[model samples]
Target: MVVGATRQSRFLFYVWQILLTAALQGPIKPDPGSQLGGDPWPEWSRSAESLASSEIEQECRQSVDSFLRRAESSLQSPLGSRHPNPRDMLFFLHVPRTAGRTFFACFLKQATPPSKRCAKSYDILRLNVSVEGCGLLSSHDDYSVTAVLPPTATVITQIRDPVDRVLSAYEFAVEVASRHLQVPLGVRTPRPPGKPRVDTRNVWPWSLLVPWMEADMRMRAAKLRSTRDGALKENNTSRREFVRLRGHAGGWAYYHSLASGASKEELSQGDVLLPNLDPYNNPLAMPLREFIEHPIVASTIHNGAALQVLGLTNYSHHRDAAKLRGCVAEVPSVREAMVRVAVQRLQGMYHVGVTDRLQESITSAAGSLGINLTGPAWRGKADAAFEYGDESVAEAEAPTRSDGPYSQLIHLQNQTDAILKELSRKQKELEQLRQSSYNSGSANAVSACFSLRALPASA
Candidate 1:
């Protein structure tokens, strides 16, 4: 039987490789069951001993014991001489792209009371991280983290791959901009007359969302014309170019400068201060500029840096920059998926950094505290059902407005709502699977499914 199983495992490996190659190169889609050609990927990839029914419970008990022992040691002798103040325990720093939503869900499970178990309000770790004199903190934007957390508290964070993070950010921006205009998927809409043109480029002038472009322009023109007649007198051609160029650029910057008390000369300099200025028009420089100037789409891009920074004071063992960089470079697909997961889970919400890093840091910290940071021990049961009621209601009540853009906006919202609901369902299923192993005396069931091997001591 052992020999037969080993042969079956080898056969499954070849099948997986073939399917993966097909998926990458062509339109071939592997069904979940046939992906491994009858052999389960999870069981085959795992060590035979790990899945053996005879010693399953024994191994899990031993693993839990080892983890608890490690945790006790960590809690007794936490790294750093200055002990964390118990009063300032819950530190929630919102890191943008790391797997924050999942982590936050874990936190919600830890912090929430059993009686008041609503998924939306259950921040078990968030509250306990503060009230119990234990240092439980997360990196994500929230009034609790921004306003309530003590100033002296330690901040924690996580990061993801840069390219994936940037792409996620772009997708999020496209989603937002699409909602504000008559744009379909894969289509760009024209700017309305007298409205400031939004350049879908690096700098997203957030203030442009305010409907003051025409009024602000008239004010700036009056100021520019007055300046032209006085101390800033120049040739008519130069003056026309300056005004025309400034107007062409958009009024957000000018209005922002004015609001911030910058002088007219300073504002004028800003208008011409092109960060990507290229007098010789070099080809190499153009691509370099495009790369650097690309807007950060997902928050995970800064996870490595944020974790290292936060770890300086929070943890005794800080991950080396080279190691972090290697990790980011190695897991491009996982990073991209994490970004999409986060954005889909928290659409239009203001908790950017909070989602990615905070939960990861806390989980790591929990592991240090001797908690079984994986399996049923760490998983929480979430009851957030994905209801398509909002989408149905919107579809039934088409607005009376004749504006195409307004109708498009409503339609996009419905689509976004559906996507969000589907994502939420997937998330709930994943969570259930994660927690099921713990409840069923099978600690590593979910990890087994992923075929994750324990890193060697050196790693």
Candidate 2:
């Protein structure tokens, strides 16, 4: 069996290589969207040999935000801008599938019987959102909502392994498509006793319904995916570029699943929640490269160096401690600027967590935010494992795996590798920082150490 599997893998790899080569032979088409083009060419590649330190610093600061800083610095200075106000509204920009719904369930204690949480779509709010009341607004957005948040409100979010995030999103797409079409997919485990459950809303996803969607939508989407796939073969793009360009290969599976609704026997054996509605669905929600985009914040600050986009702006790599380090081989400066922005913004956050280290991330963030999140609700059935979409959708999902090779089990290798690599890097960084802080007699040394012993056996 092992030999057979290896042979099959090798065969697939060769077949993919051949397909890619053949696709690359096509003549180039004059496509518009020069700036946002799928081309892998960087803006700086043409003229500059290498960016100077001063130039990089100036450009980084000017382009996005200042350098990264630890959260402890803000905790020490009471007069510093990051101090939390008791009455402050906490704006949780709940990026789908980042263990955000889980965070809301475990840590939050609404002043009222039910939390006065309101969720919104980015399209409705555009780049800015502000409400009169002191409440929580979780939205699918990047760094833009920072402008509208109350000065006292703290921003909190979680990130997943890039590969995991993408894979999970893929599963979620399958789940959602399955649900809409009344197809039985995964199995659902009963919620554990004492777990908190929050209602999640899925706003207008018109494409979910074929009747409402365009008649030729699937055809157009297929052509786009083919064109992009072919283009990718010739372009030799980066992972990020490939993600951006893969315009929805699995969309056809989604439509097939929809067509197969509620009939397991009719279901395509090879479908993977693949959709033919690629161009119509929101790109950000796709398990693609830009899934970690800085929330579209409302703050006047150009760099997004605020508490809202903390995950993006507070880290020198534009990734919070939770974000998986990308293979940023191309356009290093662009990534650097993003990291600066993340770091700068993170300084403003009360808590930031990652899906891989969800237990620690949740606990650590809760401590900073001054929330006590201990109970069966936290350790309960609700925290089954990391997955995506809104809490309600998660609730509705039955956690059964799709049958066969294309199941999530196969995808875990990439996600696991990414997670393991990040965990190792974080461990080294933490150890070094600990030693440096120990010698320097810094208070941050105490706070920086993440306590992982609190996690469950599976975690």
Candidate number with greatest lDDT: 2
Residue 143 miss distance in model 1 (angstroms): 14
Candidate 2, after superposition: displacement of residue 222 in Å? 12
lDDT of all the models against the reference?
Answer: 0.32, 0.37
Candidate 2 lDDT: 0.37
For residues 280-353, write the lDDT of model 2, one tens digit per residue: 13321222233223121111112222222543321111222112111112346646645665565555456667
Query: In model 2, where is the ten-residue run with the lowest total lDDT?
Result: 204-213
In Å, residue 383's CA in model 2 sits off its true spot by 21
TM-score of candidate 1 on Cα atoms, chains taken together: 0.25
**How does model 2 score by TM-score?**
0.38
